[model samples]
Target: MADVLSILIGLMFTCTGCLLLFGSSISADVDDQLTQDFKRFITVMPLREMFPWRITSMNYRTMAGVLQLSSALLLLLTSGVLSTIANMVLMVVMGVAMYSHWAVGDEINKLVPALICFSLLMIRLFLHLRHMPKDKKD
Candidate 1:
């Protein structure tokens, strides 16, 4: 049961990661609509717009997807020791990033999917790293 749930959770992350990347890629076409919808919540222009906003929904979603996809691929395809170890460090960074998104009061509920995806990626990363050496040795 636990293994099945774990796999399902992982699959969920992969699907959402795809959605996030897809959304970011098409954000330019939907920028106006997205901006208009949340102008009150948005502090500045969307990612599609070339502005100096510190953060944008599209930007966050895009990078989050990139990291999540990379993490997943690393977990699924990694066959060596070093790549697995690197995935561990990335997992920690991604975990902090997931928390940072909500720590600043950006509506945790809105980021639930991304949050779950991050968690799943972290789990995969951990599994890959758990048995690997901590450092490279010749």
Candidate 2:
């Protein structure tokens, strides 16, 4: 059950990452929508305020896409420590996404996806840790 859930999560991330990474290449409508969405996301992200230099929305989106893609690949292709690390990374990403939605004063509906993903990641991590060998737990 855990393995099946992990695969489903991995596929979800893969699709999300691909959409983000190739958003502009897909279609004009998608590109424009992504552009606007990222612009709004950048405005809400704390890192934008913390950084000294100007950071474009596309930069944030690209970085997120890369991270998600890499982590999803690790989660799909590996097990044990590697998969654990990937799941943690995804959790962090989803947490940040939820925070961004809250910061922007988005409605609950907008935050639901991130919240769901975060919950799933937590559950998967718990299951993974529970099944891990006691010796390698440290």
Best by TM-score: 2
> Mind giving the per-residue lDDT tens digits that candidate 2 earns over 1-138?
679878999999998988889976777798898788788989888767788878889899998899899999999999988999999999999999999889878899989999999999999998888887777554
Candidates in order: C-alpha RMSD to true structure = 6.8, 2.3
Mind sharing the TM-score for model 2? 0.91
Q: Each prediction's TM-score against the native?
A: 0.46, 0.91
Q: Write one digit per residue (lDDT tens) for candidate 1, span 3-27.
A: 3433554455466457657754666
Predicted structure 2: lDDT: 0.90
Scored by lDDT, the top model is 2
Give stretches of model 2 more than 4 Å off.
136-138
At residue 69, give the lDDT of candidate 2.
92
- The CA lDDT at 3 in model 2 is 91
